[model samples]
Target: MRLFLLLFAAVFLPAMGSSKAVCHADVPCTLGDRSYHVRAPDDWDAATPMPVLLHFHGWGRQGDLIVNHGRIAGHTRNRGVLLLAPNGLGRSWDFWRAGSRDTDFALAVIEDAAKRYPIDRSRIYVSGYSYGSAMAWRFACEGGDGVAALLAISGTIPQDETCASHPRDIRHVHGLADPVLEYPFGPGGDPRGAVRLWRDTLGCGAGETAPDYAIRPFLTLSRTVWDSCAAGGRVTLDTHPGGHFIPHGWIGWQLDQLAGRAPRYP
Candidate 1:
């Protein structure tokens, strides 16, 4: 029994240590005075550049809650990728000010991630919930060319003239019943309005309409398609039935898209 126990400890302890080395949390990085939370896959390899997914939280939420509540870390565990959840100043993303430098901070986070991990520059994705969604669109409109895709959840686009940066590839997800950030939250327009702007900017069709499946209680869903981006990319607008939360199916479909699988509308 002693020999068996000793052998097990020798093998299991090293494995446990290695696991901690891989899925560890907070792994601090700086953007000005701010220190943000970032995580990566345990099996990350430098030779195989992996796609990156950055999640921004809404107002009144921190990075840790965003990471846990959104289940982003869990989704990426077996996917061989990096998931960055940066803490915004006071749990809010600043979109109203041009000189605030939130966009620069986002890019800085990406650059920081690249220094430690193999990041596929062409496949970097940015997403956010609620107010963070507005920031996501603002960042994309200002400097989305560096990323491969964009996902905005339960939020509206920034209502600023700076939206003038030629539209890039982006996908929007929102809840029609979102009281905090409704269909037309700001003068900048709602998720639908922002998507429409992109449809025109990208020269895509008006979009094919489809029904979305209910994945949760108090949820109805719908999706619209704006096809044929400038680079053969695609844009999607997904609406959910509930409040300011992402639907399980919507997130799953996004995961599928990231995995190079055909995304099914639900």
Candidate 2:
């Protein structure tokens, strides 16, 4: 009986929770060995609910690296939005296939964070870059009402799998001369088709690629939007003049758009 109990303790308990007593943004966090990271603003209110952006890091990158990144981390902190970065298992997500275990893991990370902090689930966002963006599509599609919006950079959904019925705001950024993921569609997935999938799923209307250019003329970005969607969901696809990359000012742009500060699509 003692041996059986010891064996169970050794195997099961570790899988249930981290050995560490506390989780913080400065270091990698965990729920029974599942690795991720978190960032709360300088003024975090445990009692007051706050918005959070669950960002998935790109391939070969860990959650810790992203949490320390300036563009995203800095913007979210100033807005008092919590930032959660989850490490892909083995530094690679299984986003190539739909209904993957990584989808559940992404949701689990959010749930685990809620226990320690007062999270505003209705304002929950999921974001990513490159391969991580692919995972973001998967996460948002499978997450349903649990996902409020999506912000992806340099990548698209990996397949044509049916997405969730719930409406969600989606904003994807890609470069016209993207060499890695290639323009429009490539090894990663179909950029145009992915946004169209969201458009159709959310019941959005006609899409128009706005001709206006914000930011520098050198990096003028083209914005395409499908509005009048179900549940107020809107899909925006921003294309830049560069290669595969997170366009400058992209982070701030997303935040602004969410806060109703950016220009209207219609």
TM-score, one value per model: 0.78, 0.83
Model 2 stretches with alpha carbons more than 4 Å out: 1-20, 165-167, 185-194, 216-218, 230-232, 262-266
Writing each residue's lDDT as its tens digit, candidate 2 over 31-55 gives 6768788877645433467788888
Error of 2 at 112 (Å): 0.7
Candidate 1: RMSD over Cα atoms? Answer: 5.9
The true-versus-predicted C-alpha distance at residue 259 of model 2, in Å, is 2.1
TM-score of candidate 2 versus the correct structure, residues matched by position: 0.83
Give the Å error, residue 137, model 2. Answer: 0.3
Taking the tens digit of each residue's C-alpha lDDT, what string does model 1 give over 58-123?
788767765555446666544665777778888798877454478888888788666656678877
> lDDT at 71 for candidate 2?
63
Q: Against the true structure, whose TM-score is highest? A: 2
Q: Rate the local accuracy (lDDT) of all candidates.
A: 0.66, 0.74
Pairs that clash in candidate 2: none
